[model samples]
Target chain A: MTGLSFRYGERVALDEVSLSAEAGRFTALLGPNGAGKSTLFSLLTRLLISRQGQIRIAGHDLERQPRAALAALGVVFQDATLDLDLTVAQNLRYFSRLHGLPPRQAEQRAEEELTRLGLWERRNEKVRALNGGHRRRVEIARALLHRPAVLILDEPTVGLDPPTRRLLVDHIHQLCATTGMAVLWATHLIDEVDPISDRVVILHRGRIRAAGDVPVVLAAAHSDSLADAFRHFTPESPPAQEAC
Target chain B: MPWLLALRGIVGREILRFLHQRERFLGALVRPLIWLLVFAAGFRAALGVAIVPPYQTYIPYEVYIVPGLLGMIQLFNGMQSSLSMVYDREMGSMRLLLTSPLPRWWLLVCKLVAGVAVSLLQCWAFLLIATLFGIELPGPGWLTVLPALILNGIMLGALGLVLSSTIRQLENFAGVMNFVVFPLFFCSPALYPLYKMRESSETLYWICEINPFGHGVELIRHALYGQVSWPDLGMVTAVALVLLALAVRGYDPRRGLMKRKGG
Candidate 1:
């Protein structure tokens, strides 16, 4: 993304935002509530286009070649996008069809992902019957079904228990390490960012306050901990009347 | 081929949802049946029917209102699907659908086609009930009316799409009923002939004459008798195309309703 900006009418939700994540790396986008993390995800997913800037996913321009750009992306939105009425396998099949995968390939991929996620035993169960952790796993599996070049997750572990959250975080990190997939994980949870995370981009009020390797950001903020670095970059309150 | 597969998936989802919601099917049939069975019986004597343009001979009130009731089924089903669209938007499934790599217009068309398919099923169910009640159309009319039904279904579904794009909340659906469904049903010649409406008020007659729903009913009525009405067909086709274009524009991410966060 290059100078990506977005606004809802007069309220600027993202101001000249720009960031990048390389292959085989896990990048944490840390931000507070209403820090334009979701907005950035929306732009990346092409749900809301940014008029002022450009986004290229896997070398495909989002605006000029949206279909290619979108095809290269795998997204797990903040909200649960699964159909509660459909079985886990059924949900995956439906999404694969949307991605234009053939029946045999779709089924094979669904099985592969479900097995990898260790949810193969529960594939026939309805999504509504699954617990939060399992459901999140199913979503992650669905996102991977198309074998997208980049995986974008917006707060994938928002409401899970601590153990489940840790498990999911580790799973994503493993995916990055093994598949060499560029992963952009957005969250406000500092602990979710592992000490070995390749990079951290801290956004506050629609602007990138600090972005770099964890130790570099820590050094730049003159702090020992990632949480303290986040606090130092993002003040408790904004200066009055400045644009977001 | 990919387009065809996506279409099948989307349409299949709609069908599955329709099947699951038995109450929705029953509600759609029950509303039209009430109008056909009880309401028509009550109003039959009060409102006399002369030789309407679509009807060569004098027809019973129930027979006259059947096409209008068919329009009603499509109208309500169209709105119901749009209601689901709003729900999907709020639930984030719509976001998932929009993010698909397919062209936005094609995706919306898939949604419209799914809605029309459900509406067609409801129309046939209503016709079957009407046939049971001794309001059978000409034998060949069954085959002939397919095109008309499909056209009307698209028209009403497109209108629903337009409304869905503008409506921000699911709670505001009641407002749509009052402003859109009711007016479109009542203002058109769906329940009465234009001449009959003119007997009450000239302004209302003109309103009915111009209503695309009115032309839709006229087109279906003609097709029911294995006949054709070029003017009505043309009007319905034109209206449907225009409304569909508007609906496509309404769903555009940069400019349409999805641009707003809460909306």
Candidate 2:
């Protein structure tokens, strides 16, 4: 988005927030707590709307053609949204049908996603019976069932163990590589940012502090490590170390 | 085709959830039956029945209240939708439904349809019980009442939708809804006829006359006798459309009650 700005009455949540995510690339939107990462995600998902700037998904403008733009995008919100009363396969099928998938194709894709996520055997189990890690995986699987061109996840690992987080991160990176899908990952943990593969955009106090490849961000901050780079970018409020 | 599929998914999920909550289905059914078998039994000695328009002869008090009991089931179902909607909004599940990439209005309407489907099930169950209880009615009335039942169901369900979107949080829900559910139910011709209220109080009669729930009950009463009230149907249709339009507007991201979150 270019020149995108938003406010909650008096306080500005995001100011002139401009960034881009390219196909086959993972852009990590790194920020401190209350740094507007969620606000930005809400805008991208069209849960919130602003008329200040441009947002395009697969070259379809968001405001002018929201249906086309949103159809091409997949999202996993920060909260657990799966219906606990429904079985794993039921949740997936519900989302698939919402996207207009045929019954036969919806079932096939749901199975493939559940299996790809190593959740095939538990497909009939109620989601309330699953642990946090498994629930996040189910949500991820649901997001990918429609094969969206662009994927976005907001703090998807907030409640999971480190091992599960690492597994999910690796799996998503592999998805970005193999599927040629554009990915925007918003997080506060500095450990999730890799200096070699992923691009980084540091947001501080509702503005982009630094943005580029990991190495470029480090070089711009005159630091060798991402921790120092993050400190340099967000001098007002440091990273949420507890999150790391 | 996709819109239809989404509606099926939404309505199916609601029914599935309703069935899973056996207590809820039983609870929905218990309220109307109590009024039928318990309250109406005592109410019979106190209230005398005259030749009302829908009644050809002086009918029993239980028979007089069958349509009102049906209206109560729908009214409670509509309020149930409101409670669940508020809970869903708090739980983040509502976000999943709203962001379906379909036109937002269509999604909200699908939810409305889902609520109506569940109410229809409970109404049918209640009617079946009434039939078994030896309450006599025209045999063809069963088929005739379907359309009126659906129309009244939508009108009330849409009211629930409007209530959900208008209220921002759950803590303030019950108090606000009581003000709505009780007043609308009691003031309507659900329990007693408007003419009875007219003899007691002039103001009360006009309130009943203006209440859409009364029209809904009247419509159902007429339909159950293989009749229709065009005026009541028109009132209900206009009210349903207006409420639905408001609900659709209320859920919009740029302008609606959801935006009050500012998150």
Candidate 3:
């Protein structure tokens, strides 16, 4: 969606935000806290409707053809949404069924996704029993069950440890590279952004602060590192610098 | 086809969740059973149940209040489903459901149907318990009352959806439930006949006459005796449609209360 704008009563939550995530590429939506990343996400996901601007998913206009648009989109929200009482496989199956997959197909897809996540062994285990990282993986697997053309994650690595976060980040990058699925990952952590071959869209207070490839964004900001470029746009505290 | 799968998943999840919470299932029963056993015992002693429309001869208070107790079961279960909706809205699980490709209204109808399905089980269990306690209902009532149970359940569930959407916070839910459940129950002829309420107060009688809950319970009472109350059926169905419409509007992103609160 381009030129999308939204508000909460009198307060403008998003102001003429415009950007497009491309196919077979990772688009990192970089924003600090309260930068309208969530609002933008909500609009993109069609959870909240913006009176201004247009949104399309996989060539389907969201407002005009919501069903087709939504069917083409898969999302992993920032909060934990899996039913804790349900088994890992059960959660996956439920999600596939929601996506309209029949029982046999839902089972097959659930198996494939769980096996890919290396969680097939623990398929019968309740989500409550899994660690944070494993649960996050399950959510990712759930999002990918129907093989949506566009995959978006809102702070998907929020509570996981550094190693787990790194693993998830790498896995998503690999998935994007291998499957040619358009990926948009929103996060405040600067370290999550790859220095090479990744697109970045920086949103500051509901407006697009910067948008482009790693080198383009770096050159545009005239900075040596992404952290510096990020600091130049957003007034967030010093991010955790990469350890040498 | 996708909508069917979505509906099944939704209903299946609701049933699974209800099963997981044994305390909730047991709690749904305790209130009605208490009314049937203890309160009915005292009420039986205090007043007599005149021969009602469904009753050919005078019936015991236990037997007469059975339908009302059944209505109470669905009412609470419906509100309970609403409470969960509020919880889902807060936990962001609601986002998970809304993201599905299926229409949102269909998803909500699935939710209402699922709640009714669970309440049907509770009502059956309550009826069994009542029989075990020596309350005699017509044997055919067990089957005849199913449709009535479903109708009342949907109407009450739709009411809950409207309530849930208007309520912004979980903390306010409990207060609203009590405020709603009590008035709807008491204002209706759940405990006594409208005639009894009329003898007490003309105003309360009019409230009972118009109360959808009253019609629902009366419908159940008539159905239990193998008779159909067309007036009650029409009233319940009309109210159900209105409430469901309101609920759908309440959840719509652009037009409903969701626009103000940001679901």
Taking all chains together, each candidate's TM-score versus the true structure is: 0.96, 0.98, 0.97
Which pairs clash (backbone N, Cα, C closer than 3 Å) in model 1? Answer: none
Model 2 docking category = medium
Tens-digit lDDT track for model 2 on A1-244? Answer: 7888988878998899899998998899988888988888878888889878788888989998988888898999898899999999889888987888899999999989889999999999999999999999999999998899999999998878999998998889999999999999998887776668999999888899999999899899999988888988888785545323
Clash pairs of candidate 2?
Answer: none
Give the runs in model 2 whose Cα sits over 4 Å from its true position: A242-244, B260-263
Q: What is the lDDT of residue A27 in candidate 3?
A: 94
Supply fnat for every model shown: 0.55, 0.53, 0.66
Q: Write the per-residue lDDT of candidate 2 for residues B145-170, one digit (tens) a residue.
A: 98998999999999998888888788
Candidate 1 lDDT tens digits, A53-133 = 889999999999999999999999999999998888878878988899999999999999999889999999989999999
**What digit string (tens of lDDT, one per residue) describes model 3 on residues B208-230?**
79989999999999999899999
Model 3 misplaced stretches (Cα beyond 4 Å): A236-244, B256-263
Measured against the true two-chain complex, the DockQ scores of the candidates, in the order shown, are 0.53, 0.64, 0.63
